[model samples]
Target: MTALVIIPTYDEAANLAWIVERVLAAQPQLHVLVADDGSPDGTGAIADALAAADDRVHVLHRVSKQGLGSAYRAGFAWGLERGYDTLLEMDADGSHRPEDLAQILAASATGADLVLGSRWVPGGGVVNWPWHRRLISRGGTLYARLLLGLDVKDATGGFRAFRRETLERLPLDQVASQGYCFQIDMTRRVAAAGMDVVEVPITFVERERGESKMSGAIVREALWRVTVWGAARLVPRRLRKGPRPEPESLASRPGA
Candidate 1:
């Protein structure tokens, strides 16, 4: 099964080259597509250089800064058009270990429709993060699980793999969340579609280079979006999910 890993970036030049090399080294057949949003720090130029050197490396340059949701949506559509059987998401920073890509793919091959590299699962942990940061991440995930009723442990995780069929069946065009909330958006969609989702242990490390995009705005977005989704689900189905798009799976919906 062919796989394509999508790495989204904005001013990630410091870590871009290193991350790309590590990803390619992890699996010889693994193809990488760097989706960059016109970073002023010459990140796009660096990506172009990498693509020029390696046939397996590709680049998608957006004219301006778009949210992670849109970047992944574009990358997914690109991979689907070219007929990749499996697609994956990884951050540009070093947080997502390239070595773990093997485990994620192995899980997918063993019949998992989606594989999440969860830091909260048994054998999973983080490196170099202080207590409060860990609390924020774990807390946010916990709050989301409580509100959304998702069975997954790390609902806010970004490291994930998906079979192409799963993405096609999901309402990709309708996803609106951008920040960390994008993870929750797709997680809910996967559960809503009743796909076989699995979680694997992965060590998430704090980025040694580049600034973290996580901020008050991003945190607020996750809180607000998750809260709104939870409240909407509490409403009667006749006024909510009943009128949505067609060909979309709703087997996991409430009272479906």
Candidate 2:
């Protein structure tokens, strides 16, 4: 099956090429899409150079920094238009290893609609993360799980693969959440649709180069959005408002 991995970037010039090459080397059927959000550090130029050198590599240049969800939405549209069968999401940073990509893809090939590269699963773990970071991740996952009724171990993990059909079925126009919330929102939608979701163990390593995109604002956004959505579920059917508008903003991927 054909697969396209979309890597969202803001100022990831230091780690872009290294991660792209490794992703390309991971699987013969894999293609790379670098969704650059007008990084002034010449990340867009670097992506252009890579795309020029390798046919499998492509670049999508946005006017300015958009949210993580926006980049994936654009990338998914591009891949869907080009007839890609499987679409994957990964960080531009080195944290989401290219080596584990094979396992995610393998899981997708085995009839799973959505496959998450999970750290909380049995064979998975993280490296170089401080205790606070670990706590936030675990806590966030548990919170989303309980509120959203999700059964997966790592609902907030960004390293994931989606069958093209699954994306087509999802309400892409309504997915406005960013960063951690984006991951959780997508998981909630897939589960609500009764899709086959699989979690595969992956070793997540914190990025060695470039600054992390995690922020207090991102965490705060996730907490409130999840609480709002969860509360909506408990509302009396007759008095409930319509569906909440999906969140949209300029943000980046943290470990969560």
Q: What TM-score fits each model?
A: 0.91, 0.93
Write down the lDDT of every candidate, Cα atoms only: 0.93, 0.92
The regions of model 1 sitting more than 4 angstroms off are: 237-256
- Cα deviation in Å at residue 177, candidate 2? 0.6
Candidate 2's residue-wise lDDT over 123-195, tens digit each? 9999999999899899998998888888999988999999999999999999989978899999999999999
Worst lDDT window (10 residues) for model 1?
240-249
Task: Tell me how candidate 2 scores on lDDT.
Answer: 0.92
> Distance (Å) between predicted and true CA of 16, model 1?
0.5
lDDT of 1 by residue, 142-215 (tens): 98888888888898889999999999999888998998899999988998788888999999999999899888
What's model 2's lDDT at 142?
A: 92
Best by TM-score: 2
Model 2 ranges off by over 4 Å: 239-256
